[model samples]
Target: MGLPMPGDSLGDALAHAATLLLEASSVDDTLDAIVRSAAASVPGADHVGVTLAHADGRMEALAATSDLARELAAVQESIGEGPCTFDPDTAGIVHVPDLWHDERWPAFAEVAAQRGIRSKIGVRLYGDSASQAGLSIYSARPNGLDEESVQIADVFAAQAALAMGKARVIDELHDGLRTRQRIGIALGILMHRYSMSEERAFAFLTRASSHGNVKLRDVAAGVVADFVAGLEQPGGG
Candidate 1:
């Protein structure tokens, strides 16, 4: 999808963005598309980046539309203090009309000014209690983003959050399915070889997992591999 026309409504622009996100195939792809949409929807936004809070409390840029946006994100991560670093749930929307003189983030502001980013706006995206995230828009001109722009950005950020949340859920579901499949295959092997009941085979696998301090799935995988190796041995089977 492309940017809205001059007379197009912000709501319409946001709808288009949601469509693009829905068509995305993965988490990375969804984030990349959202950042691009932010640049298009927000007035005077020359660059955009998506910041993600990891489960470990580390923050990093997930995707950016330009090198400048990526560089700025890295700078903020290094300093550990910037609009993007703030918890969106509490801080709300953060708008810096003039980064060149913003006292709240002196070090970051100074460095950002050198890169021609005179203004910035960070809108919080959706995240769970374990993590948080936001979208950061960069502009080269002071007072580049106005109230209307900020409002539109909020809408875009919300849509991006929904898309990211769904993508993550899908990823988790796929991972869970694969883990179950591996464990089931290993259980079958154990049952066939040992003439044990399914419950007994599962119990054996669980004990092995606890004894080795490994995950149940990993233990299952190891059992399957060993069985395959035995079948391939000379004068074996």
Candidate 2:
């Protein structure tokens, strides 16, 4: 979808963004689309970045529209302080009207200013038990982003989060299907080799997985590999 025109209502703009983001085919594509749409829609957003923060304190930049945006995210990750590094549960949106004068994150602000970023806004995207996300908008002029910009960004953040969550669910479903297929192949191999029933083959796989302290999928994969190896032996087939 294209950027919203002048005098367009916030609802209309967000609806368009949601439609564009939901059309993304993968998690990476969803993230890229979110950043690109944000740059086009959020006011004074010269650069945009999406950051994921894990409960274990790891921060990563998932997508960025420019090198400057990526650099700022890296600085936050290195210093362990910045709008993108804040606790999503306890903090509200962060707005830096002038990075040079902002004191909340001196190290981050210093680095941002050095990179020619004068203003910034950070909005929480989504938060769950294990991880959360933040959207960072950067501008080249002081006071470039105002309250209205924050309001606009908040809407975009919600749309981006929804898109990301949906993409993750899709990935999980695809992974589940692959795991089941691999396990089925392994079970077939075991049933054929030992003349065992399906239940007995599954139990055998379970025992091997527990004894080896390996995941069931990994254990199943090993069984399939062994069967293939035996087939390749001299006069084995």
Candidate 3:
């Protein structure tokens, strides 16, 4: 019933966690694994969560190991500041030895103190991507995130970033495959109805997409939908 812990060796832990990420069935599952790994493996981590900043500037923490972690992340999102707000792309790493006494993020520190969190650690994940994210761990005791803990958290964050990258790549591949399938079906429809060659059909779809200022995939989808609709019409093929 308990989650797996990281191995004694950091490399081994990273490899095992990477394998799990690759095997994750969905993006949610991969994120869940990252949080769980942090909570179980990282020293001084009583709870773990992930804060994701979308390209549209929306921030959210949908993957967390406990309610406390989720609440803390929500507070940061609402206030627009916290350990997870660190720009991993530029700032690299951040370690908060005592949130209750940390003056840098007063609003967040107040909220965290009220929630019984005394210390925290955040390592940016996928910092170079359009969607910035970080892995955060919270503790109820002051000075919990020491140097060793910070090092461990760094390794954990690195592994998490790798997993997130793999998950996104897999999602993009699936989307690409689906788009290709739709385009192929639309091409088939155009060829059968208009007696057009494959090259001509694709060109026509491209021209339509350019003229309409729409994505080729969307244009192809519309063609497929129209073809299907025609089939449902009375005395129509």
Candidate 4:
């Protein structure tokens, strides 16, 4: 659904957008909601995109409202220019009111203009020394975005950052629980099969993990798989 009408106060629209963002069920869903909300709420925002930069120097196009947005994000990543490539911690907001005349990012502006995108804006969503994220809005007309659009986008970016951070934490918690359960099951299996105590069974798994240079969870999963495979053999159960 669209955000509150322009006649309504910006505060009211931001409140509504925040509710929608919080209702997202996963990280992907949250990114999608943020882009959709920005497209609907920000004036002159013809398309929107979200890009996440990981600590390992990986760049991901998390979400986009249109192919144009995705293409623009790719251009920014490949050329290492444009607002999306800015340091999120320092460049909280970057605006290109007219792409054709903008010289700050000549290569980026050339590519954008070729794609019929005349204006663009990027708002920092979240950032740390190792990783960062930003939202990009594209327009087809020169001077398409204004200060009002920037203000509205800032609110949306803030809400988006909070939603994304919470989603990541929830995901990490779920992964942790799953890993613990798998390790526990593997320990039980080892203890029963080798007539060893719980501590010894765990130590065995740890040693195997260290020796093989594999993750503990992966080692545990392999043990569980072997047990299941053995059980499936004739007269093995």
Candidate 5:
């Protein structure tokens, strides 16, 4: 089986690709869609790459069009000069177009040239809070990413980033006051029943997630579900 191709024109391609992102049921699905879109939309964009988590600590391309682009982006991310904060150039990472004229990434440039990549464009993925996740796009042609292509890529990046940012804020982040209040009630029960401290109770829940090989949020969700379930029962404590 082959992956779907969106369109011939860049705009049509992006519009089609946007449908995929919109249809995505999860964050990972949306990002994977973006990478595939970039590779397919622009002419000669043989490779595409993107960073995951886009947060401050670490940057990594979750999806890449080729092993070479992926490796280079990771190297730049590892060096810590790339777009941890979302720089427009190189998409907060490293990009090499005519490595002969550009030696920004000495080692990566060598590797890119050896890999036969002549031009590349990296548009950083940003969050609603304006944080960066990663960059995407790569090419084997010398003049692959022209102005129009870059603009189109930027539109794609902005749309995907906005969607992803919204999803993260809703899923991973919460209004702390509300979350703390809801969890505090549940934590209080655990502490009273098990003789644990505030911090210890939270750790116990965290460890339960680790022990069960699940997410802490999943554990918290279960706690809330059980609390709601208990309230429905007769004489529930």
Candidate 6:
């Protein structure tokens, strides 16, 4: 009925953050809330960072406002490992008081330190049940984030993990649908080009996928693309 009294205390702030996490309806919204809450929970935090990794270990930044933070995020992505790529054995609260001294991510730390980022705190966004999300807060001030900030991040991580999981599921389904659509289109092209039945075209694509050690949809798409491109050549239909 009433907001908790405005205070900087960790307990109060965590309660507020927990409430925010509970209210999130989507992964993007949950991440927005998490970042806002991270900045709120910390003492000198000026910005918050969020990232999601593809199945290929390519990390993509979800949200970051500052230019330097965005660049640093891109660097981590290019390297494929950084503070966000922490050991699963880590119990909780992976804290880096100073990026310069953190040897674990030597390249990432060098790049980040040069970018004027002094500290970072990363919490595992996904637990043992799922793997895709990762949360990290980047700070420009030296040794900025405190213990309370880590706890707040961890709590937010757990609460929003459900939404993150849902997003992953939805994303997978969308990708599958797209793959099927592409495969079907490619199969149709093959059928027309080869004067073969749909069933036979599909079988050819499947056999090619298995023989080439490539995905079925990929093989189909490549075949169709090549066939179409041939038709575009001189004296071709």
Candidate topping TM-score: 4
Instruction: Please give the range of 10 consecutive residues that has the lowest summed lDDT in model 4.
Output: 1-10
- Candidate order (TM-score): 4, 2, 1, 3, 6, 5
Top candidate when judged by lDDT against the true structure: 2
Residue-level lDDT of model 2, residues 1-237, one tens digit each, is 675554567777777778889998789989998998888778788999998877776788999999888888788888988888847465658899999888889998888888889999988887777777889899999999988899999888888888898999998898899999999999999899899999999999999999999999999989888888988999876
Clashes of each: 0, 0, 0, 0, 3, 0
Using lDDT as the measure, what is the rank order of every candidate, best first?
2, 4, 1, 3, 6, 5
lDDT for model 6: 0.71
List model 5 lDDT by residue over 1-237, tens digit each. Answer: 133364456666777777777766556776677777777775567777776534454556677767876776666666554323344343332344565456565555566667776676766565444345665566667776666667777777777787676655555554555666666776886787689898998998889889999866567767878877887899976
With candidate 4 superimposed using the best TM-score fit, by how many Å does residue 142's alpha carbon deviate from the native? Answer: 1.6
TM-score of each: 0.84, 0.87, 0.82, 0.89, 0.61, 0.62
Q: lDDT for model 2, on a 0 to 1 scale?
A: 0.86
lDDT of 3 by residue, 1-237 (tens): 244464456566556666666677667888998888777777778999888766545678869989888888778778877777635355767788998778889999998998899988877776555667878888889998788888888877777777777788888899999999999999999999999999999999999999999999999999999988988999878
lDDT of 2 at 198: 99
Q: For model 6, how does the per-residue alpha-carbon lDDT over 92-146 read when each residue is reduced to its tens digit?
A: 5678888877788899888888878888887667644333456777778778776
List, residue by residue over 48-90, the lDDT tens digit for candidate 4. Answer: 9998766554667889999888888778778887777746356
Q: Candidate 4: TM-score?
A: 0.89
Worst 10 residues of 5 by lDDT: 82-91
lDDT of 6 at 183: 92
Q: Model 4, 221: alpha-carbon shift in Å?
A: 1.7
Cα distance off (Å), candidate 2, residue 198: 1.5
